[model samples]
Target: MPGPKSNLIDLEILDGMPDGIALVRVDGSIIHMNAALRHMCGVPDEPGEPLKLESLAVPDNIAQWRRFFTHAAEDGGPMSFDATISRASDKFTFYAEVSFHRKSLHGEPVIVATIRNMSRHRKIEEALRLEESRLEALLRLNQMTGEPINRICDFALEEAVRLTGSRIGYLAFYDEEQEKLTMHAWSAQGVKECRISNRTIEYPIKNTGLWGEAVRQRRPVITNDYNAPSPYKKGLPPGHVRLERHMNVPIMDDGRIVVVAGVGNKPEPYDIRDVRELVLLMEGMWRLLQRKQSEDQLKMSLAEKEVLLKEIHHRVKNNLQIVSSLISLQSEVATPENMTAAFKESQDRIRSMAMIHERLYRARDLAKVDFGEYLRNLTSYLKSSYQPRTAEVQIDVQNIMLDIDRAIPCGLIVNELVSNAFKYAFPDGRRGTLEISMRKDENGILLVVADDGPGLPPGIDVSNTPTLGLQLVHALVGQLDGELALHREKGARFEIRFK
Candidate 1:
């Protein structure tokens, strides 16, 4: 007796409704019910034209429901509550969502109540929560893999004992070459703190014990019932009666077997998959430790090389000083003018080599020398070279260090420059002041050698000077890969920028 469109609307509403429905009067008398309510009440019959609300079977918390209904009937209008209900089969429990609403039906005040079964949904929620917990635990294991092996092994032993609800666990480190597995750590507080003075153990790896099998096969081995006939029975120590289960996993370092992490006295056997996962984590931690050890060894080797180089420089300095003393002694006994001049030249050569070693001794790096110190020493030697009894030479140096390759050529250039100043710049009883100064600027090394004597001979151009000293200076500057500027302001200023 319904039209097609009206029937379609009724079907849609019925399918969309979430829970059971019931109609009751203000006084709590049952009037009508829906299919969902019939299933929940576990009765198919209407029971004498709609049973009384209190007469119909309900949950033990029905008094709380009535109180909620009365409260909804007041000015607030509607209320909701949750409770657990038992099914008629007596095998299943359901979470019930109940709602009460005060409304008018057939122009009479009534209360609309609804209930929904939530047992299946609750199961799904619990499963999701458990999966999330497992994922978090796996993440913690991965983070532990980044630490050192000793720490990782310690954490693994603690986790294994805790997971199995056991009171004792120990880890044995396998010495592959020596065929030994020594107990390194134990869960018992007193045992771990005990000093292990006796380090060697006669652990035979070729035997059928759990530690030997794990190391030889590169896998994990478990003994669930150690009390029964077991391959590892002989490996147990004397008076060791409490161990009921055991598991051993191999730890690898750089793809090579390193240690066997054997756990004993477990409450029960661990799964094969769990043993494999823990071994894999231990392998990763061992790899990190191996890399750190290699890097430390490399740094130590480099430090030793530096020490050897410094010692070589120190020996060279001592040898050159002995050569300089020989040259000075030879020059003191020479009488002929030519012999004295030859001996003096020999002394100069030895002094040059001595300067190199002297600078090397004070340098932090043996491969280079301080350029400022070299220049000052060379100028002082040249001032003495002329045997000038009146004029005094002064040196103004700046801070700079040059590699040995550059220092040698630059030192020779300073020697020639100072020699020219003492020889020709001052002649005929004329006293002069020679200033040798150097500075480092953004451009490069700024070296100046000037004198307060008569300027270069009137007919000599600095660019085309025919002097041997000038020629040597030009060649040395070229070797430095630098440029030279000639200034005729006070005396002769040869300014160079050598990078």
Candidate 2:
């Protein structure tokens, strides 16, 4: 609407402006458009019929735009505002800030408008906001401990679906060796939208199609166009939620896939960003599950150790009482030699019980002890206790192991019998040999302590014997539900057998 003489000058000035520029009437018809403004609104290059400014606007934004023009026409002042603009027939759309001033050209009221696109700035802000949300979700997941794995997996899947703009999702545990899947979780929205009840909870790798491609190929699978025909496309289950677009990623540990997670029905096409989000969430979830399993195992082991400790404390208390009784008995002995001997016997008995606990504390497997190793240590101690003896102690024991209950009594019985050998069988420093042998015999054990010296007195009823050593051996053998027999051969041979 500029004069003909100044039209070229005004046109040149408008074209030189960086911001989009347009001249319009209050009725919404365009008077003029600069090249920048024409491109912003998706205008055609060729000149044609006069264009209406309303035609270039989004349909839903027309009402606000009309109001903006009305205010500009009446106020006769510069005005500014922000809104969304789009060409309805195309995919062109952007957030824009519009500044305008009412003017008069050739005595007709006109409006000069300038547009500054803000779409890129808004997108960057939204991306940062989403990234913050993802970090916060990961922090919460890492804090989860001792929770049921299904609950943790479900939480992770829900976040994956929400953060990726998907409406449905599932998490399945994969067994690489078996090439199978165990359905672990389904998002809450997925369950509600899916009308299929008692859905298939497992599937073999070979039987799966598109979604399983992520697992088969060991990478992410994205289907931006769900209806695109392909051999991998399979029919959905009856009453299952419909899908327009889908994405999934495989979670890998070492070189094998450990989990498969799938999401579907995103509003926009799935992209690499969605794949990255799902991968991070699923990996963190796997770590949380592993930590929970380890915590459960540690709790169970602590419980078992507590029970074992109680049993050990009980055994130690009983042994201490027996030691007290032995000291009392030694005090009643009338001879110094007999008292010294009684004291030595008591020291060996205490050491026997102490040795069992010491070995248990150091053992890899706390439930059983190496009986042969225990006997060897015991014999070495006894030989050192009975000094100045030339008798050779020959031992033949197998690699038999026994639990603490059996080991304690069996060790005490061996102590009493072997001590008796060094004391009575080898008098006058008898230059002979004492033999000890133990072996497993058909669901029972055989223990023998023989000395090549004078044998036990004839008609000695071990069951009614008044000697403390024989009495203790009888009691301990009875505790094991075993029997003791004395064979008078080249020496006194005591054989004890028990299951």
* lDDT top scorer: 2
Reference-based TM-score, model 1 = 0.36
lDDT of 1 by residue, 78-160 (tens): 78877666554342456777778887754667777777777778768755764454445445655753466667667656655
Q: List where candidate 2 sits over 4 angstroms from the true fold.
A: 1-6, 105-107, 146-148, 254-256, 296-308, 318-499
**For model 1, the run of ten residues with the poorest summed lDDT:** 1-10
Model 1 stretches astray by more than 4 angstroms: 1-156, 159-167, 189-202, 206-208, 239-241, 265-268, 315-499
TM-score of every candidate: 0.36, 0.67
